[model samples]
Target: MTLALLPRYDEPRLLTAQMELIDQSFGIAMLGCSLAAMILASGLAITGGHPGALPWAATMVVACAIAHFGRLAVPDRLTEARSGRYARAMTAMLVLIGSLWGLVAWLYLDIRSPAVVICVLSLIAGMSAAALAVFSACLPVAVGFFVPAIVPVWIVFLATGDIAYLPMFLGTPLYLVVLMIFARNYARVARHAIALRFENLELISQLRDQTARAGQAQRQAEEANRAKSVFLASASHDLRQPLHALGLFVVSLSRTTLDAHQRQLLTHIEASSGAAREMLNTLLDFSKLEAGVVTPRPRPFRLQPLLHKLENEFAPQANARGLVYRTRDTTATLFGDPSLVELILRNLIANAIRYTRAGGVLVACRPRRFHVSVEVWDTGIGIPTAQHRDIFREFHQLGNPERDQRKGLGLGLAIVEGLARTMQTRVTLASTPDRGSVFRLRLPLAWTAPEEAADPQIAMRLDGLRVLVIDDDAAIREAMAGLLAIWNCPCRTAENEDEALALLDDFPPDLILADYRLRGHRTGHEAIAAIRSRVGRRLPAIIITGDTAADRLRNAHADGTALLHKPVVPGELHAAISTLMRESEWSRAEQ
Candidate 1:
C-alpha cells in the first residue's frame, strides 16, 4: 500500500533519470548504512550480551556488503530495456536490508533491559530517516525500505501491552507517517528539478534547429540573387549583338545615294531603331540600379547648359506633337553628377512629351540662396491624386493600357527616382487632373572655377588610316568593316586574338577596336595588351560591349579603356574613334 502511494513518472526519460540518480548515490548510501549497522550491533552486543545478537550483527553486515557489491557489478550504462529491472532489484535489496534491521529490533526487545530497548528503537528510527534521504529519487524504493524497517518494531511494542510501551506503540505510527510525508515531499522536489533540466535541454535543441534553418535560407537567397545576375548578363549580351550589327548596317546604307522616298524610309527606320534602343537602355539602367552598382560622380556645373541640352532634344518632339515646349534657364551653379542630373531631367521631359496630347511643357530652374530646383511642368492629361505615389513604381504607366512601347517601358521615372536616391536627394511631384504635373529636383549650390569650353570638333576623315576590328560574331565583324569602309578607312578583321595577332604581322593598323568578351574565354583587354606588347608601342584602342551586368560595367569603367555600349549610335561611334585618333596623334607628336 505504501508503494502504491509513491510517485509515478509518465515520461520514460524522467524515469530513466531517476534511476540514474539512484545508481550514482547507491555506494554512498550503502557505506553509511553499513557503518550505522555496525555501530548499533556493537552497542547491542555490549549491553544485552545476547548470543543471538552477535550472529544477527554478522548477518546484517554480510547483507549490506552483498547488496553494495551486487550494484557495482551491473553495467555502467543502463539501457531502457534493463533500467526497469535494475530499479526493481535495487528496491528488493534495500527492503531486505531494512528487514534485517527490523530483526535486530524484534530480537533485542526480548532482553528485558531498559537500555537495550531504547537502543533498538533509536536504531530503527535512524535507519528509516537514512532510507528516506537515500532513495527519495525513486519514491517506491524509499517506501519499500521505510515500511519494512519501522512496521516490525512498532508491532513488537504493541504486543508488550505495558503502560510504558503504550505511548511508543501509539507514537510510532504517527512518527512513521511524518517520515513518509517528508519522503513524498522530497520525491516531488526531485521530480520537478529533473523535469526542468530536460525542458531546458529540449529548448536549446529547438533553438539550434531554428538557427540552422535561418542560415540555410540566407544562403539560398544569396545563391538565387547571383543566378539572376548571371542570367541578365548573358541575355543582355546576346540580345544586343544583333542590334549593334543592325545599327551599323543602317549607317552604311544611309551613306549610299538614294531618292527622297528612300531617304524618308531610312529616317523611319532610324526612329524605330532609336525607340528600341531607348527601351533596351531603360531595362539595363533598371537592372544596374537594382543591383546597387550605380555610383554618383558629382561636380559643380552650370544648370543653363544642361537645361538647354534638354530643350534642344525635346523641342522637336514637342513641335512634332503640336505641343508648346519652353525652357527658363538660370545661371545657378549646382553641385551634382551632371550626367545623372541630365538623366533625371531627360526622363521627366520625355514622360511629359509622351503624356501631353494638348498642352505645352515647361523646363525651368529656380535659384535659392542655398540650392537650385530644376522643375519640369507638363500641361498633359494630369495624373490622378491616388496614382501620384504609384507613378514612380517600375513598369507602371497611366492611360497606356495597351502597353505601347513608344510611350517607353514605364521605367523612366523609376530610374529617375533611383538616380535621385544615389545622389542623396529626393524628387518632388505635384499634379491635378485635367491640369498638369510638375517634377522638381532640388540640388545644392556650389562655387567653382569657370567651366572649360567644349573640345573643338575634329575632322571625321579616316582616309588611309589602317584600322583593326576583332569580334567573335561574323555579322558584327562584317557590319563593322563595312561601316569603317564607308568612312574611307582601310580595315582588317579577326575572329580571335590569334587571328588578330596574325593580321597585325602583315598589316599593323593605326587603331585597334575589339569586343569585350571574345571566344575561348579571352577578353578584349587581353587581346589589346598582347598586341601592344607585340608592337612595342602603346596603340590607341577601344572596347565595345553589350554586357549590362553591374560587375562587368564596373570592371569596364576601371579598365581606363574607351568603351561603347552595343547598338552604338553612328555619330557617337564616329566621334569616339575620331577623338581617340586625335589624342593618339598628339601623344606621338610630343614624343
Candidate 2:
C-alpha cells in the first residue's frame, strides 16, 4: 500500500475513545473509594460515633459516580444535562450533610480516634461531588467545579488528621498523578495523528502539481513533433515545385544555342535554383541536427581563402539587394571543423540579407584575449525581443508570415545554432526590430605567421579537370554532367558500380564524385573500393547523397571518403573538386 493510504490513528475518533477511557477509569476508582469510605464510616458508627450524616455522605459518593457514569453513557444531550443537574443537586445535599456530620463528630465523638478521619473523608467526598456540578468531565468547564471542590478539602486536611485519614490524603494525590500521565499520553497521540494528517494533505497537493507539470510537458513535446511533421510536408511540396520547374526550364534552354539575353535568363534561373536549394537544404539540415545526425570533421584550412570565396560569391547578391557585405582583416586563425564554421556564417549572412531591405550586412572578425569573435551585423528589419529566442526553434518564423516569406524555410538560425554547438563555439544575437541585427560567433584563436598565408596567385578554376560522376538518378546525372561541362570539366556519368568500373578501366579520372545510394543494393563505397583495388591507387572521392539521415553519414565515414550532402551547390562542387585534385596530386607525388 502507498504511504498516503496507510492505516493510521484518527484524531477525533481517538480523542472520543480517550475521553471514554478517562470516564470509565474515574468511575470505577470513584466507586471503590466510595465503598471504602462507607465501610470506614460504618466502623465509626459501631464505635457509637454521632454519624447520621456519615451514612448520608457515603451514600452521596456512590450516587454521584453512578449518576456521572449514566450521564456519560446517555449519548443524548438533554438526558445528559438532566443527569448532570441531578448529580449537582445530590452534591449540594451531601455538602450540607457532611458539614453537619463533621461538626457532630467533633462535638460528641473522640477527637483522637478514627471519627475525625471519617469526618475529613466525608468532607472531601462531599466537595468532590460538588466539583461535578459546574462542569462536564469531557469539557474544559470541569476545571472550575473541580478546583472549588478541592479547595475546602485541602483546608480541612490541614486542620485535622487521624489513622483512617492517611488513605484519603495519599490516594487522592496518587489518582491525580495517574490521571496526569494518562492525559499526557493521550494528548501526545492526538498531536501525532493531527501532524500526520497535515503532512498527507501537503503531499497530496504536491502530487497534483507534479502530475499537472508532467502532462503539460508531454503535450508540449507532442505538439512540437506534430508541428515539425507538418512543416516538413508543406516545405517538401512547396520547395520541390519550384525546383522541378526550374530544372525543366534549364533543360529546355540548354537545347538551343542561346544569345546573351537567353544566357542571362538561364543564369537567373540557376540563381533561383540555388536560392530554392539553399532553403530546402536548411530545412533538411535542421531536421538532421534535431535528430542528432550531424557530426564535425575537424581539419586545418586557410581561413583567408574561404573568406575570399564568400566575398566573391555574395558580393553580387549584396550589391543587387543594396546591402554592404564586408569582412575584417585579421591574422588570428581558428582551429575547428571548417565546414561547420562556413555553415554558421552562411546562414547568418543569408538571414541578414533576407531581413535587411536597404542597409548593409557586415562580417567582421576580431581577436579577443584567447579567442576570435566573428560578427555578422546587418541593418534590417531586426528581430523582436520576444522572437530572439524563438527564431532558433525549428520552423519558427517572425513578423508577417506572408511578407517575403518565400525567401527562406525559417531554419537558417536553427542550423546556425546547431553548427555552432557542434563546433564548440558560442553564438550570440542582438537585434532591434526594423533597425538592425548582429550575430557573433566566439571561437578559440589559432597560431598563424606571415609566411603561412595561402598563395595569392593560385587560380580558382576547374578547367580541363577530369571528374567521374556516379549516380542512380539519370536526370540528376545529366544535369550535373551538363553543369560540370559548363565549368570545362571532362566529366563521365555512370549508373552503378559496373558502369563506373568500366569507365575507370578505360580512363582513370583525376577525381571521383559518387552518389551514396546505387542500384542493385550497391553503395558508392563498393564501387570506389573496386576501382581502388583495380588501379592500386587511393582515389579522392566524395559521397554525395540526398539522404540527410544519420546512418548515411556514418556509412560514408566508414568508407573513408569525404562527404557532401545533396542537392549540391555549384560553388561547393567546384571547391570540393579543386581541393581533392590538389590533395590527390600531392599524395601521388609523395608516393
Candidate 3:
C-alpha cells in the first residue's frame, strides 16, 4: 500500500528514496502517540463504567508492544525489495488499531454521565487526528484505517439518533480528506525534485565528456601544426640549395660573351630564374618574419630617395602593363626602418599594380602633427568592408581564384603588416567594392634629416679583393669562382672547412663567403671564427645559407655576420660585399 502511493518515474533511485521516507514514518514519536492514546482512552472507558474497557486496553497494550518492536525492525527491512511485504503488514496493523479506537468511541456513547461521555469523545477525536498525521502519506493505508474506524463512529451517531455526535461524524471525514490532498501534493513535489536532480547530473556528465573530447582535439591539432611547420622548413632548405646554385650560375653565364640570338635566350632564362627567385625570396621573407629575425632600425631618413628607388623599380613594370605608376613627392623625413618601409611600400605598390588591370596606382605622403602617413592608392578592384581585416592574414587573397604565382603567394601584405607591427606602426585600408583601395602606413616623425648614402658608382673597383668561397657543393663553388672571375677578382673555392683552411697559406683570402652548413657538422660561423683566429685579422665575411628553420636562422645571424639566404642575386651580393669592405673593422682600422 505504501509502495503504491509513491510516484512512479521508472527510476530505481526514486523508488528507493520513497521507501526510505516511508521507513522514517515508523519512529519513536509515532509509537509514543499511539501508546499514550491507548492509555488515555482506556482510563476514560473505565471512568464511564464500561466493563469491556479492561480487555480493550489489554489488546491495545499488546498491539502497541508489537508496533514498538516493528518500528525498531523497520529500518533493516525498509528496502524496495521488502517494501511491498512491509506495506501490507503495516496496513493490517493500522486496521486493527483503528478498529480498537472506534470501539472505544462507541463504548463512550453508552455512558450516562455527560462529563465521562465528553471525555471518551475527546479521546476518539484525538486518536483519529493522530492516525491522519501518521497514515495519511499513503492514501490506501489512510483508507484502511478510516473505513474501519470512521465508518463505525458515523454509524453509531446515526443509529442512536444522537444530535451531539453529528459534528464529530461530519468534521472528522472532512479533516481526513484535507490531509490526503496535502499528502498528494507533497509527494508530487518530492518526485519532481528527485527527477530534476538526476537530470542535472546527466547534463553535467555530458558536458564533462564534451570538454575532454575538445581538449584532445586541440592537442591533436597543435601536433599537426608543428608537423606542418617542420615539413615547410625542411622543404624550403632543400629547394633553396639548387635554386641558389642555379641563380649564381645564371648570373655568371650572363657576363660571358654571347650572340644576339643566344643573348635573347639568356635573357629569357634570366627572366625565368628571376621569377623563381622572387617567389623563393618571398618565402624566405615570410620565414624570417615568422622567426622574428627581421628587426627594424628606425632613424630619421629622407623619404624622397626611397620613393624614387621604388618608382624606378616599379615604373618599368607599370609602363609595360600600360598603367600609370605615379608618386607624389614629399620632403617629409620619416622615422622608421628605410629597408622595411621600402619592403612595405614595395608590396603595397606591387599589389596595387597586380590588381589594377586598366587603371593607375598612386603613392603619396601626408604630413601630420606627430607622424607621416604614407598612402598607396590604386584604381583597381576594391575590397569589401567585411574583408578588410581578413586581407592582412597570410595566404588570403581576393580575385586571384586561379592562385597565380605571379600575383604572389598572398603573403606580401602579411609581411607588410608584420614589418609594420615590428616597427610599432599600423597599416589601415579603406575601400569600396569594384573601386580601387588605399593602404596607408603611419610612421613616426623625424626632427632631423639623416645623411644620404652616396650612390654606388656605375662600376666599383674589386681589383684588389681576394675572395674565398667555402661551400660543400661543387656546382655552387664553381659558380662562385666563375662569377668572381667575371668581376676580375681572384678567388679560391673549398669543399670543406679543412680544405679552405689549408688554402689560406697560398690564397690568403681578403674576403670570406662561407655557406652556413658545411661538411663534418661544421658551420660557416665556426669556420670564420677559426679563419679570423688563424690570420689574426677581422676579415670581411658573409654567411650565405639556405636554412629556413626559425631557431637556426635566429642563431645563425646572432653574431651580426652579413648573412644572405641561398640563391643570392649577383647585384645584391656585390653590394653586400662592397658595404662590408667599406665599413668592416679592417677597412676602418687598417685602411
Candidate 4:
C-alpha cells in the first residue's frame, strides 16, 4: 500500500538541473548532425546545377549550429529563466526546429530525389538518436524515445516517392514495441524499489511501537514503586499512632487501679487498634494490587456463604450510612477464587456505602443456565457515563473533587477490576449520574447435587498455627508477632537468615514470612532456604516486604514463592497465615 505511490521525478526544478548537465553533450551531437546534413544537401542541390544552393545550405547549418552552441553555453540561465512552464515550451521548440530543417531540405534542396534525400534523412535521424542517447537531459524519457524514431520517418515521407514511405511505415511498429519493453523494465524496477521501501517503513513503525510500549511500561513500574513507598510510609505512620495508644492503654490498665468506665474505655481503645490494623492491611493489599503482584488461582467455591459473609460485614456500615444493604441469593455454588470474589464485592459495597447519602445498596445473585450473575446495585453518587471507566483506574476519584478526604485510597475499584481481569470475568458497570450504579460479576456456577450438599453455613477458623516472620524493621516484626499472637498463632521474629536460623534450632516454624530485602548477605528467600535445609522439608513461605520493585516481584514469582506487603493489617495477616498453614497441613496429609 505504501508503495502504491511514487515520488515525482519529472518536477520542473530537478528536470531542469538534469537537462543542464547534459546540454553540452547534446549540442555537439546536434552540431555534427546539422553539418553532415548540410554537406549532403550541398551535393544534392549542386547535382541539379544550382549555384546558390550550396552557400544557402552551408549558411543554414552554420547558423543553427551556432544557435545550439549558444543555448549550451547559457544552459543554467535558460533552465532558471523558464523553470516552471519550460518543459512543454522547450519540447515544442525542438519539434519546430527539426520540422523546419526537414521542410527546408525536402522542398527546396532535393524534394523528388529519393537517394539524395535518404542520405540527408539518415543524417538527421542519426543526430536525433545521438542527442537522445548521449544527452538524456533536454527532454523526458518519452521525448528521448520519440525524437529518434519521429525524425527519420518525417524525412523519408517528405521525399515524395512510393518507396520512400516504405522505410517510415515499417520502422513504426518496431519503435512501438521497443518503447513497450523499456516501459515494462522501468515499471518492474520501480515496483521492486517501492516494495522494499514500504517494508523498511513498516519495520520502523513496529520498532517505534515496541519502544513506546517499553517506555510506558517502565514509567508505570516507577510510578507503582513510588506509590508503594508512599503507602508504606503512610501506613506505618497511621498504624503507629493507634498501636502506640493501645500499648499505653494496656500498660496503664496493668499498673493502675481502674474504674469500670476506664476499663471500658480501654476496650474501645483496643477496638480502634483493630480498625487501624484493618486499614493498614487494606493499604498494603491495595499497594500489592497496584504493583501487579497478586496472581489469582481460580477454584470452585460456594457462592452463598461468601455473599452472606459480605452482607454480615457491611450491614451495620450501610445502616450507619442510612443505606439499605441487602442480598438476594441464587443459592448455587459458583466457580471462581472465592477470596478474590469476596474482595471485589467488599470494595463495591464499601464504595457504595461511602458515596450513598441515602437510599439503598443491594447485593443480588441470579442463576443463569450455567452461570450466576452477581450484582451490587447502589443508589449513590453514580459515576457519569464518561467517568465510568476512569473510576476503575488507579488513583482516579470522580464526583468528589477533594478525593484525599475520602474513606479509601482511590484504589479499591482498581483492584477489583484487576482481579476480575485475572479471573477472566467481565465487570460491567451501568449507571445514571447522581441517581444509581450497578456493578455486575458474571461467573460460572459449579454444579453440586442436593445429595452432595453438607451444612451450607460455614465459618473461617484458624487456630494452633505457627508463622515465622523475618523482617529488618523491629517494630513491624514485633507488631506482626503481637497481631498473630492475638489471632492464636505463635510467631517468631528474625532480622535475617542468622536470626531465623538461631530461632529454628529450638522451634521449626510451620510456615515462613520473610522480607524481600534483608540485612547483609541475606534475603527472605535465603532465610526460607536455610529453614528448609535445616528441617529437611519444604516450608510454605510468603515474602513480606515494603519494596514494590517489579524485578523483586518477578524474582519471587520465578522462585515459586508467595508475597505480602508491609504495614499489613491484622485480618489479612490472619488470612495469609491461615491459608499457608492449611496448605502445609494438606501437603503433610498427602505425604
Name the top lDDT candidate: 1
What is the TM-score (0 to 1) of candidate 2? 0.57
Off by over 4 Å in 4: 1-108, 111-300, 405-407, 449-469, 478-493, 502-513, 535-542, 557-563, 571-591
Clash totals for all candidate models: 0, 0, 1, 1
Pairs that clash in candidate 3: 244-567
Shift in Å, residue 428, candidate 4: 1.8
The digit string of per-residue lDDT tens for model 2 on 1-591 reads 575642232235333433443444445544554665576566656666546747555665755566556556756423333434433443443344344334433443443555555555564555344334322333222332333334444445445665556765566556434433443454455456646766888899899899999899999989887675566745553455446335644764677799999889888888778777776677667756766657787655556666777778787889998888887666556777777888888888888887788878888887789877888889988888888789887667776468464667677888888888877777999998888988989887666532354555364688887889888877777777887778788989999989988887677887788877788999888888888888887878888765544455456656668877666656676787777777777887898
Candidate 1 lDDT over residue span 277-368, tens digit each: 88778878887788676889888888898888888899999999999999996878889999899999999999999999997999998888
lDDT of 3 by residue, 396-469 (tens): 99988999888888989999999999998899999988888999999988988697777765545688689999
User: Where is model 2 more than 4 Å wrong at Cα?
Assistant: 1-255, 259-268, 284-309, 324-339, 366-372, 384-387, 450-470, 477-513, 518-522, 526-541, 570-591
> Could you tell me the TM-score of candidate 4?
0.60
Model 3 clash count equals 1
lDDT of each: 0.85, 0.65, 0.79, 0.67
Per-candidate TM equals: 0.81, 0.57, 0.76, 0.60
For model 1 the TM-score comes to 0.81
RMSD of 1: 4.7
lDDT of 4: 0.67
Q: Write the per-residue lDDT of candidate 4 for residues 400-516, one digit (tens) a residue.
A: 667654466677788788889878887899999889899998998876532344554333465666778887767667666666666577778887788888998777787787877
Best of the two (1, 4) by TM-score: 1
Give the better candidate number (1 or 4) by lDDT.
Answer: 1
TM-score of 3: 0.76
